[model samples]
Target: MRIGLYPGTFDPVTHGHLDIIRRSCALVDRLVIGVAINRSKGPMFSLEERVAMLEPICAQMSQDTGCQVIVHPFENLLIQCAADVGASIIVRGLRAVADFEYEYQMVGMNRALDDSIETVFLMAEARHQAIASKLVKEIARLGGDVSKFVTPEIEAKLKDKLASS
Candidate 1:
């Protein structure tokens, strides 16, 4: 089976992330959503919360897409995580030139680390090209409407989390 790894902080999964997930599912036999432990970025949700939020959504997506989706948490090296999960390919979404530059460098590094691992880049759909989780959180924190960017469940959770903080 062609196993692909889609790794991200997913502080809160946005439509953009889901778009990539949807596209990646069609390309690989099995897709694993690797949630990174990135405390340095100061995510809006805890690691546990992020994983919890993704589980049900991934499960439903797997049912809908017929692509087995698994959410797993990882720390430190991403290349190691991919190896651990037996992922032969790393799937990434590119939104713009900035994304391309960054991801291009990472792809090179990942190749150096694991010669057998290949990287695939999927361009974000036009509607979601500008939607990023960081920006979504920022907009939501300032009371801006993010209903269009994230799911209702995530929107509610983001609003509540921001309101309490």
Candidate 2:
């Protein structure tokens, strides 16, 4: 089986992400959506909460797409996580020129870590190209409607976090 790893901060998975996940599923036998740990941006939800939020969304997609999906809160090195999971390829969603610049370097670094590992970049569907988890959270935090950008569960989680703060 061709295992593919899709790693991201996922503070809360957005529709744009789901879109890529949906498409990527068709290209690979199995896709592992790794919730990568990043201390710099500081996630809105705890790691546990982050994993929980991914469950339903992932399940729904897997059921509909016939793709096996796993969501894991990966706390160590991204390349290590992929290797541990036996993923031969890393699936990434590229939205714009800005994203390309960042991912280009990341792909190179990942290749250095494991030359056998390859990175596949998929362009976001047009409507979702501008949507990002940070952008969704920012709008949701400011009381802007993000119902369109994220799943219902993520929306509720974001709303709850914003309310508590």
TM-score of each: 0.98, 0.96
lDDT of 1 by residue, 32-140 (tens): 9999988888888999999999999999999999999999999969899999999999999999999999998998898889989999999999999999998998898
User: For residues 92-164, what per-residue lDDT tens digits would candidate 2 score against the true structure?
Assistant: 9999999999999998888888899999999999999999888888899789999899877778889888888
Best by lDDT: 1
Give the root-mean-square deviation of each candidate in angstroms.
0.7, 1.0
- In model 1, the clashing pairs are none
lDDT of each: 0.93, 0.89
Off by over 4 Å in 2: none
Stretches of candidate 1 exceeding 4 Å from the true structure: none
lDDT minimum window of 10 residues, candidate 2? 36-45
Q: Worst lDDT window (10 residues) for model 1?
A: 156-165
